[model samples]
Target chain A: MKVAVVGAGSIGLLYAIRTQEAGHEVTLFVRREQQIELICNKGIQVEGESMMYDIHVKNIMDISGAFDLIIIATKQTHVKKIVELVKVNEIVAPLLFLQNGMGHIEDIHEIINPTAIGIIEHGARKLSDRTVAHTGVGVTRIAAVTMKQEDLIIYKQMLESSHFPYKLENDWFEVMSDKLIINAVINPLTSIFKVVNGEVVNNPNLFRIAKKLCEEACDALGKASVEYHLDRVKKVAMQTKDNHSSMLEDIKNGRRTEIEGISGYLLKRANDELPYTTFVYEGVQAMQQMDRREYE
Target chain B: MKVAVVGAGSIGLLYAIRTQEAGHEVTLFVRREQQIELICNKGIQVEGESMMYDIHVKNIMDISGAFDLIIIATKQTHVKKIVELVKVNEIVAPLLFLQNGMGHIEDIHEIINPTAIGIIEHGARKLSDRTVAHTGVGVTRIAAVTMKQEDLIIYKQMLESSHFPYKLENDWFEVMSDKLIINAVINPLTSIFKVVNGEVVNNPNLFRIAKKLCEEACDALGKASVEYHLDRVKKVAMQTKDNHSSMLEDIKNGRRTEIEGISGYLLKRANDELPYTTFVYEGVQAMQQMDRREYE
Candidate 1:
C-alpha cells in the first residue's frame, strides 16, 4: 500500500512513521523545504512510549504520485489548502482527514475521492523538523465519510498494527461529534487558562468552567449520547494531565489555532442557545488574533 | 477637623496624608502592628507628582475617639470587616466609603450614620509599609449615599485642597455605575492578559473585547447615559497604560481581588443577558483562586 501523510505536524509525522513501520510505502507531504531536506537526509525520529526508531520515508513538497491513501493530518485551518492541493494534483485515492473539529467535514464532502474521517487519539508532539514525540498511545477511530469497500479494506490493511490500532466505525458523524465535544471543551479552556490538561481538572474552579463548556457543547450539537461528555472530558484531562492541548501549543508557538474550527464552529451552530459557548468562542478568537499579531 | 482614614492601603494613606497637609488632624487606622510601628517611627512617604514628602501622621490599630470624617479606604472585600469594626467601636461620624463596585453601596447602607461614596481617581500604590507612590493625580468624586448638609460641608473642608481636588456630585449611583463600567472592563482584562493598562488599548483584539464588555455592562446596568463607555474605557486605558490596574496588582501580589465587587456584581445583575461578562467574571475569579492556592 502506498500512503502519503499530508502536513508535517506531529500527528502527520506519527501516522506516516507508524504506517511505514507496518510494512507499507509511506511518503510525507510537507510544505517546508527545510523539513523535506531534514527528513530526506536524516530520516524521521519517532520517540516515546509506542515507538523509538528513526525510519526513512519519501518526503515531497508536491502531491505528485498516486497512492492508496492520503491522510489529511493538517489542522482544520489548513484543510482547505490540502483540498486545493489534492484538486490540483487530481489524486483519486481514499482521503482520510484527521482534524480537531467538524468544520472540515463540509470541505471533505467536496473532495472527489473515497473520503473517510479519522479521530487520532494518540498524543504526539513535533520535537523538531524531523522528530516526533509520541507522548501517548491511543486507538485511531476511522469511519467512512463517503467510502467504498475496497478503499476501506486498503486503509485497514495499511493502518492496523499490533502497536498502532485502527478501528473502523460505521457512523463518522457520531465519532466526529463525540470527538468535537471533547475538543471543544478541553482545548479552549486550557488555551485560555494557559494550563496543562491536568490543571484543568486539578483546579476545582477550572474544572467547573470546563464542565460548563462541555455541557454547552453537548447542547449545541444536540447529541444526547454525549450528555456525559463532562466526565469523559475530565477523564481525558487526567489521562493527559502533563500534555498541553494542540490549541495551547499553537498559541504558545505563535501559530494560527484551529479555534475557528472548534469553538467558532460550535458558536455558529449554537446560534444563541449557548451563551457561554459564544463568550468563550469570542474570547479565544481574540486571543488567537492577539497571538498572531504578536508573532507578526 | 479630625479625619481618620481606615485601612492603611495606598488610597487610605494618600487621603490621610493629603488631609493632614490641608491642616486637619489626621489619623490612620490600620490592622497590622508592623504598619503602626513603621508609620509612628518613620511617618508615611508620599511620592509622585503634585507632592513628594515624608509627612508625619498618627497611626493606630484601634479606632480611638471620634472623628469628624471617617474614610473607609479598604478594598471592597474588607468593607464588611470595616463595618464590623465600626459597629464594635461604636464610632459615630460621617462615613465615606472609597471602594470599587456598587456592592459596597448596600454594605454602606447598613451603617447607621451620615454616609457618602467616593470614586478616587488618583492612582496610588503602596511601595512599602510606610510609603505610598501617588502615581497619577485625578479629581476625586464624592457623593452622598446617605448624608446631611453639615456632614458634607465638614467632608469638603477636610478633603478638598488645591493639590487634592474633590468634586461633590448629587447622584452617587450614576457616579459609581460609570466608574463600575470602567473598572469592570479594564481590571479583569488586564489581570487575565497579565498586561499593563495600555496594552488593553494597543492590542486591537483586546480593545474589541473591552468594547464588547463595556456594551454588556451598559446594558446590564440599564444606563443609556454610558453608551459611550467604550470610548471612556479606551481613554482611561491609554491614560494609564504604564500602570497595572489594582486588580492586576492584586493578582500579581497574590492578594484577594476586588472582582467580586466589580465583575461579580455585574454578573449577578446581568442574570442571563450578559454572557460575556459572566464568562470573563468566572475566568478572573478562577485565576484569583489559582493565585491564592499557589501563594498558600
Candidate 2:
C-alpha cells in the first residue's frame, strides 16, 4: 500500500516508519524547509519498546505517485488545512485522522466524501525530534465513514500487519466520544496542575476535579454506554506514569496549546455552560500566561 | 520620647525612621548578625519619597534604656514569640503593631496587657538588607488602649512633625477591619493570580472575585457602622496602584506569606458555613500551591 503521512510531527514520523516497516511505501508531507532538510537528511527514525528504524522521508510537494492511504497525525487545529491541502493537491485516498478531541472528523467529512476514518491509538512522544516511544501495545480502532467497506478493510489490514494491534469499528462516533471524554479529563488536569501523568493518583482532590471534568464531558456528549472516564484516565495515567501530556509539553516549549481543540472545544459545544470545562479553560489560559512569562 | 522598633523589617525600619525624625530617641531591634552589622556599620538608611536619612540601630538583647513607645512590625505568624521576647527581655511600653491582617494585636494583647495600639500604615521594601523604601506617603492610624493625656498629646505632636502623615482613631476595631478588607482583596488575588498590582484593575472578573472575598472578611468580623468592604478595597487599590503589595514581594523573596494571617483567618472564622468564604478559601489555598511552585 502507498501511505502518505502528513504534518511530519513526531507522531507523523512514527506512522511513516511503522507503515514503511510493514512493507508499504511511505511518504511524509512536511511543510517547513528546515523539517524537510532534517528528516530528508536523517530519514524518519522510529524508536519503540522493541525496535528502532528510519524510513525514507519526502516532502508533500515532491511526492510523485498517489497514495492508497493518508494518515494525518497533525494537531486538531491543523486538521482542516491538511484536509484542504490533500484535497487541492488531488490525492483522493482514504485519510485516517488520529488526533485528540471529537467532532473534527465531522469537519473533514463535510469537506470530502465518506472515505475518511478516525483512529484512536495510544502513542507516546519520547523525544523532541528523533522518536516516538510506543509504550502501549493497545489496539487501534479504525472506523469507516458512511459504511465504506473497501477503505475499512484495507486500512485495517495495513494497521494490523504493521507490527501493531488494530481493530475495525463501524461505529466511529462511539470511539470518538470515548476518546474525547478521556482527553477532557487527562489533558486539562495534567496541564493545569503541571504534573506528570501519574501525579493525579496521589492527589485525591485533583483526581476528583479530573473526574468532575470527565462527568461534565459525558453529560455534554450524552453518552450512556461509555465507561467511567476517570477510571480510564487513571488506568492510562498509571500506564504512562512518566509521560507529560502533550498540552503540558506545549506549555513547556512556549507554544500555543491544543486547549482550544480539547477542553475549549467542549466549552464551545456546550455553549459555555459547563462549569468544570470552564474551569479547565481558565486554567489553560493561566498556563498560557505562565508560558509567556517563561520565554519573556 | 524614647521609642523601640522591634523586628527591623521594612515596616519596622520605616516606623523607626519617622519616629526618630520626630525628635524621639529611636532604637531599632534586629535579629540577624548580618542585619545588625549592616545597620551598625552603615546606619539605617531609609529612602522615602522626599527624604533619605541614616539613624542609630541596636540589637534587642543589648538594649538597656527604657522606652516610652514600642512598635512591633514582625510578621503576624510570629507575633506571640516576638512579643514574649520583648516582654521577657525589655520593658513593655505603649506597643504599636503594623503587621498585616487581624489577629496579631489581639494575640499580643492576650500575652501582655491592653497597653498596645494597632496601626495600619502604608510601607514597602526595596531589598532585604540594604535600604527600606517608603513607596507611598500615608498616615499611620493609632488607636489607643490606655494612654495618659500628656503622652497622647506628645505622641500626636511627634507624629505630626515626622513628615509622614498621622491619624488617631478612637475605634481600633474599625481601623483593623479596614486593613483586613484591603488585605482580603489585595493579598490573595495578587498571590493567586501571580500578576502585578495593576493587573487586577484590567481584569474585572478577578476584581469581582476579589470583592467577594472582601465581603466575606467584612461579614466574618462584625465590627459595625463601616462602609462596604469592597468599596474600601477599591479606594486603597486606587491609592496604591503602583505599590508592589506585600504578598507579591513575599512571593518574589520566597518567604512564607501572611496569607494565613489575612485570608486564612477570615476563612477559618467563616466556620465552613458560607459557600462564598469557602470558595475564597479554596482559591487562596490553590494560590498558595502556585506560590510554592514558583518560589520552591
Candidate 1: lDDT of A191? 82
Model 2, B1-296: lDDT tens per residue?
Answer: 77778777778777777787877787787778788888777776567345544656666666556777777877887787776776676565676777778767557565553353656566567555747877766677877655554565567767566467767777766787778877877876665555655545545655655655565677777645334666667777777666667776675566767877777677666644433344334444444454244212
Q: What's the iRMSD of model 2?
A: 5.4
Would you estimate the TM-scores of all the predictions? 0.92, 0.76
Candidate 1, B1-296: lDDT as tens digits:
87788888888888888888888887788878777777777777686444543443444446768788888888899888788878788888889899988777667888797899889898788888777888878888988888975667667866688879988888888899999999999999888777778877887767767877888899888878554787888889899877888888887777889888898888778745575676678788788777343221
Interface RMSD of each: 4.2, 5.4
Top candidate when judged by TM-score against the true structure: 1
- Give the per-residue lDDT digits (tens) of candidate 2, residues A123-242: 656464645666555566878765477768867776666457678776777777777887777777777556777765545545656666777787777766435666777788787766
- In candidate 1, stretches whose alpha carbon ends up further than 4 angstroms from where it belongs are A48-60, A291-296, B48-60, B271-273, B291-296
Q: What lDDT would candidate 1 get against the real structure?
A: 0.79
